[model samples]
Target: MSYEFITLKQEGRVLTISLNRPPTNPLNGVFGQELFKAFSEAEQMEDITVVIITSALEKAFIAGADIKEMAAQDAAEAEQFSKLLQGANNILNRMKKIVIAAINGHALGGGCELALACDYRLMTSGKALIGLPEAGLGIIPGAGGTQRLPRLVGLSKALDILLRGRTMSPQEALAIGLVDKLIEPENFQAEVMQFAQELAAGAGKALGYIKAAVYEGIDFPLEQALAVERKYSAENSKTHDAKEGLTAFVEKRRPEFKNE
Candidate 1:
């Protein structure tokens, strides 16, 4: 589970994964492979209830894909690389634990798509930018960008961004709902970790069920989605955390969820 291009740190119930390729953590074959390994490891950890994704560099979270590596790839190699990236992204999207993108700096192309895979995005204030800019490179986003971006920011806005290969400033990104929260640079890391830890402390089983209900339900018809939600709700109600939560509410005290 060791990673060469990324660093994993665990504290309490939260796991933080940092892209470690300095200068600009450009996505490459190795990066994608390492990311998949990291997520797989995280998924197996019993204590991990939340995951935060960020970068080790302050100047750029991830500038883009490794253009030099891309240029050296043949058609078959490029397709394989795309599939690898997509696989990594799918792991993030499908994780039961809550995933937050702590976007410290610019996140373009594949990096932006990576952020979109997370459940929440917290961006730093100031000049940091984020967007999918693959169109300018005579290519489209080969990862989940083309699908996830439109689902998140709506089809029209997503098209404008993709077609123009535009990058958005932090404030602009927030206005467009691409980012959930904008934190000042000085307190970015601390605040993001604090928020993640808060989420980790919640009822883990219920949180997982909520995530499943929303993620899986979105693709289903209204009736089917409601059924999906109802099923998870019924399952969650049988857990110890749900009982404790209800009892604590009546007792006027905080519930200590065991994630059982």
Candidate 2:
């Protein structure tokens, strides 16, 4: 599907969704709408196992929210915009695919929130910065940032970063678990594609179920969380991949997962 603010490229089992709005990709009503559509479509695609969200722009993953648009918004408009973005962000967390954020450049404000929604983040080295700088702008992170950041890192660290509106380089972000990996800026795209392809080779259904189990179970108590794991575990045992995997083990051979 064509999008006004984003571009979709599919290769084998991997789907790459690039934020295409030029300069700083500002998160706005149209951008949010397009993002929602793209991710929603990706979530339903049976062939796609891994989804990679990145930037086509040279120096941005996404800079932030649309400040000018926000400044002009009345209460109702602000609420609508917030809801739109919140919905888009939630789709990322809920999607079955193993979603990855290839942070090629700066990811700030809503950008950081978007990245946080992904299953993993790999940032390009050099000038790329990632963080929630909303507090400095006389606001707070209205998207998933406020909630997800603290969950990934601890509460104390998230508070310090959010309150100061701090931005960190790829290394610093990795040190604090903001980003999962860092790649050389020069080889960033190639590395990201290789990473995505590796993940895409895995059993799609099992990968998704594992993601669902962890995300769903994290909020529950131990027993309830174990039940969540058991639910997904039982569900995955019925998959084609599961059968192939077990049969392959019995045969002492590698499993050829078709993601069926």
Candidate 3:
């Protein structure tokens, strides 16, 4: 399927969704619609085990939300726009497949929120900045940033970033646990694809279960979280891949998981 503001390419079991808006790649209503459409299409594809979200522009992964568009919105329109943003963001967390954010450049405001929604973030080293800067614009992150940021980086640091609307370098983001890995600019895309391909080669159902356990269990109490983990673990163990894995282990061979 084709998208107006995004492009989707699939290679083997991995799908790459690149934001196509030029120069800044600012998020808007159209962007949100197209993103959700791309994700919906991805969800329907049984072969796609991993999804990578990135930008086509070299200077900005996503500069921020489209201010010109927002400036024209009234209360009702703004509320509707927020709903669209939230729906788009929800795909990242609620999808059964893993999503990786390849932060090639600056990701601020809504851009940062988009990255935070992903399961893993691989950012390019150097001048690229990432953070929630909505406070500087007299608003707050309308997506999941306010909730997901603290979950990833802790309350104090999340508050510091949100309140100050601070954008930090890749190194600082890594130190704060915002990004999972940092890659050299020269080899960033190749490394990200390689890492994603490695994940794609694993047991897809098991990976999905792991993601479900972590995401769904996070908000629950300790005992409840363990119960959630146990549920997924038990369910995953019944899959064909799990049986193959055990058989391969006893036979002293690498298991070829079919993602069953």
Candidate 4:
């Protein structure tokens, strides 16, 4: 579907969703719906094995929610607005495809929450900042930030930033394990594409199963988690790629994965 705030681009098996409501891709209901549509379609497409989320502008990946929009909402409308945005970004977590958030610039408030939904986050090694700094605005982050941030960076760390509305530098974000990698500004897009291409070329079924194992079992008890993992593993073994991979290993040849 065509989107006013986003653009879809496909390269090989990698699908890149570029948000472009510059000078900062501020979150809004229409943007939320469009984002949900983009990811929902990506989730079902067999040709796309990996998805990259990035901003078209270099100034800000997403600065925050549109304050003017938020200011006009009552409590009920605010809740609905928050949910809309959450549902959109949450698709990144639910999709089996490897989801990478390429933070090209500032990612604060809702922007940070969106990034948190991705399987991994890579940031440009520029002056861009990232955080969940909604407290200073007299509102708390309502888009899965409270839950996901704590799970990602620990309760104390997440709380400290959330309560204080403090923003962190890219280097600081990497140190706190918020962002997985930092690519130099000059080669950020190239490096992000390269990483996505590498992941897209892997055994698709195995990749999906691995993601399923983690998300499905993360909150389960040890035995339950193991059972979840085993179930996915058994399912993965049934794929053609799995058989070819094992056979190639035994034959001492490179396994050619067709993403089966």
What are the TM-scores, per candidate, against the unseen true structure? Answer: 0.97, 0.98, 0.96, 0.98
Where does candidate 4 stray beyond 4 Å?
none
Q: For model 1, how does the per-residue alpha-carbon lDDT over 1-260 read when each residue is reduced to its tens digit?
A: 67788889999999999888877998888888998899888877777889999999978988899999999999999999999988888888777889999999999999898899999999999998899888899989988999999999999999999999999999999998999999999999999999998998999989989998999999899999999999999999999999999999999999999878
Residue range with the least summed lDDT across 10 consecutive positions in model 3: 1-10
Candidate 3, residue 43: lDDT: 79
lDDT of 3 at 35: 81
Model 3 earns a TM-score of 0.96
Cα error, residue 60 of model 3, in Å, equals 0.9
- The clash numbers for all candidates, in the given order, read 0, 0, 0, 0
Model 2, range 197-242, lDDT digits (tens) per residue?
Answer: 9999999899999999999999999999999999999999999999
Q: Which structure among the candidates has the greatest TM-score?
A: 2
Per-residue CA lDDT of model 4 for 1-260, tens digit only, reads 77898888999899999999977999888888888898898998887889999999978999998999899999999999888888887788888789999999999999999999999899998789999889998999989999999999999998999899989999999999999999999999999999999998889889988998998899999999999999999999999889999999999999988888
| Candidate 4, lDDT over the whole model | 0.91
Backbone clash total, candidate 3:
0
120, model 2: CA deviation in Å? 0.5
- After superposing all C-alphas onto the true structure, candidate 3 shows an RMSD in angstroms of 1.2
